[model samples]
Target: MSMRVLKSTGAAFVMQNMRTCVNKPIYKETFDVNSLKKICDMLVVSAQQRKLVRLAICPQVTQHQIWTGALMEILNQLEIEMCVKDCMKGSNMAQQIVVNCLRFLDDVVSYDPDSTSWMRVAPKKDADSSPSAKWSDLLEMFNDLINCLKNDHEFLFYVIKLEIMKEGLSQIKDVLVDKNIGYKEALHQQSLVHKKLTKSLGHSSRCLFTLLLYYLYGSIQDIELDICWYSEDVSGNKLYLCVGKIIASDEDKMLMHIFKQLDRALGVIKFVHEMAEMKEILEIQGHLWCIGSKNRSFAYRGHNFFIHGISLE
Candidate 1:
């Protein structure tokens, strides 16, 4: 069938079949690898046409059938050199294919069939025939691609760096350490691969570093804004000062407000200090308020006061 027609009909067919099997188990014995491969090939054609096609297949089918056969076919076509060559010339078809392949692989590996009752694990025939073994093989392929990207195709590597980190590093980690598979050795090996990948990428690009920090800390906050506060009692007898730092993930408008508050606070402090020196007073009587308008306020000794603060950017 022509790919144009296939793209339209293939997804409908798969969705229809999937809907019918909603409450039923999809056995590995009855899984159709050839059909899955044909669908994957059509996805490639869709990418070549610069069209977006969403193909929804059973995750069980993807995990079991595609990993063993169809996935290799997709991966083989994801050539880094092709992507780089096309990208340099202002074409994105090759890069699109790579993206589609990554999306397919993501769908295959990201699904957690162990938590569902509709997908049963196929019986293992030997040590090398289990699902964990398949995952190990998949990890090996990812490591090979990553190494190639790091060593030779630096440009293409940065282009798809986030997707690789999300799928290869994040999702694959979940698969390797799945309680059902329990592949500790495989997980350890994957960790080593990640360490090498990160070390190599960390030197040249901040993309991987940002992603790694997000994965490690659950958020990326690289911009540290130091803040200081100065306050005095109503009697102006005692001075209180607090200093700290804020780690911001992005420079949003809220940060601008913080900056303004810091500037205002610094001005107030300077004015108060100069006046205190001019009068030869031991301390200033009025508050050196440097707090943002929206910030928290506290009441002390029947007087409400704002915290004096400034950012050391």
Candidate 2:
């Protein structure tokens, strides 16, 4: 063959070969906001149905893993949406994503206490066998979503605060009033608290609701006490008085100002009693009562401590 003809023929062959072996650009999977919302909605429905089945008939099914996987996928997509800073910002889909994430976590916590440790919730067996699931990635995803909670997502914040307050009220309801003691009245009071807390999304209103939460759940670690701890140890009646007093005091008004002041006053009284107990402890060690001395220093110190702690609170 002629050199020119051979070169042209070779070039044509090479071009054909290149065309045959052309590499298509690999596209990464991307989901838009609507797609994400739809995914989360379907997953939520599936999880709910699974929970019902697990609760009703078959308790041994491997359901949490399925639920967790769905949650992980949703969160990963949401994180990407958050990073992209596009049309998803402050959208209803974003809010729904957060709310659904929290609801999933709450469901997990409620169903599988073992899953509370996010780092290890994914089955370890999958690590040695399957290459698909990584619990560590799930943990990272969870942490990312959790950190997002502190952002200026007003709806997200409101939902989280409302959930916390509702959980606190649920805890306190039993402690405050049970079947034997005005259960109907207790339900009514809880309904009122719920109504009040859900009324306004204002910061001050949120603060007031959160204050009620703190009174119910906040620890008096300085005094080494809390409502739950006290309720568990002492009679329910006294603790009931402390919690129910606010609802009882202003059943008609249900004013935040009145409840807040009452809550603080009760806290002070509680600390004062706690101080007296500490003074007794000192007395037991012969610090308060000496052989030939009548120094009321312990009482004075207890009173001062009570006053200082209340002021600090």
Candidate 3:
């Protein structure tokens, strides 16, 4: 462990006897965002205090590394620090709130957390560590997917935008609401931001979604999908929020197909959502459905979409 660690990372507060929720049934929670923000805030404050201390009793030039590490720790605090300015759920916030959320997402994504050291969740031991399974292969695949998440946001988003364009305006409204970016202006802002970012960066860029999917499961399967805002009542009441259909089958072929494309489609969905919520031109998140017939009945298939405790699309 590095001796030059920042005090009050806010980890203690986050772990202060909080209810231990693993994978949520509906949504996934990765790093504690609120805790992250508070840590960043303190790191910033500590820097100011340090500056005053430095002025009075400046350390030796050899001690520069210590101060540098301190600053670096603050810079690295972004792993958890997200802009808590926006509501995590609900469609009530105005365009400003949407923009605020987008900005937070943008900064969070754009800021390279790997640039400096950050807290990492411990890895789980594979059950197949015995002589039978290729344990090294599993580690390689896992590492590859992590890289994909780190680098593959833009390529994934492009397909999502295409899908959203096909989904129509009312559908677009549903998308906004799902991501907590609702109302006329916020949706428009996301579109506008995406346009600006994509314009300078070129329209066709590649991301790591497919590659990562291939790395992890050898393909994307066990995906959950839905169709939203396609139905309207006679008087035009918003009845169906989103229709979910998990593509599953007893036959390996059908299940495999869904699994293979799932990562790619989810990559697309995440791309769309990230781009939409980014303050600048970052991608938000988006998901797709492949349930054509829904004939297969597997006990495990229904809950496939929400694996990591985070929402899929």
Per-residue lDDT over 1-313 for candidate 2, one digit per residue giving the tens place of the 0 to 100 score: 4534433443333334334221221111111111112212212224444333223211111122332333343345445545565454455544455555555454332433333333432334444663432223324333444454546563363334433333323322322212112335434443443343333222123223233223333421111111110111123223211111101122224334333433443443333234223212111000111122222322222222111001101
Best by lDDT: 1
* Model 1: residue 161 alpha-carbon error in angstroms: 6.0
For candidate 1, write residues 10-33 as lDDT tens digits: 333333443432222122111111
Model 2's lDDT to the true fold? 0.30
lDDT comparison, 1 vs 3, better candidate? 1
Which portions of model 2 miss their true places by more than 4 Å? 1-89, 112-257, 268-276, 280-313
Model 3 poorest 10 in a row by lDDT? 28-37
Residue pairs with colliding backbones in model 1 are: 290-308
Worst-scoring 10-residue span by lDDT in model 1: 25-34
Arrange candidates, best TM-score first: 1, 2, 3
Q: Tens digits of per-residue lDDT for model 3 on 142-176? A: 23323332333432332232222221222122212
* RMSD in angstroms between candidate 1 and the native structure over all alpha carbons: 26.2
Model 3 vs truth, CA RMSD: 27.2
Task: Report lDDT (CA) for all predictions.
Answer: 0.35, 0.30, 0.27
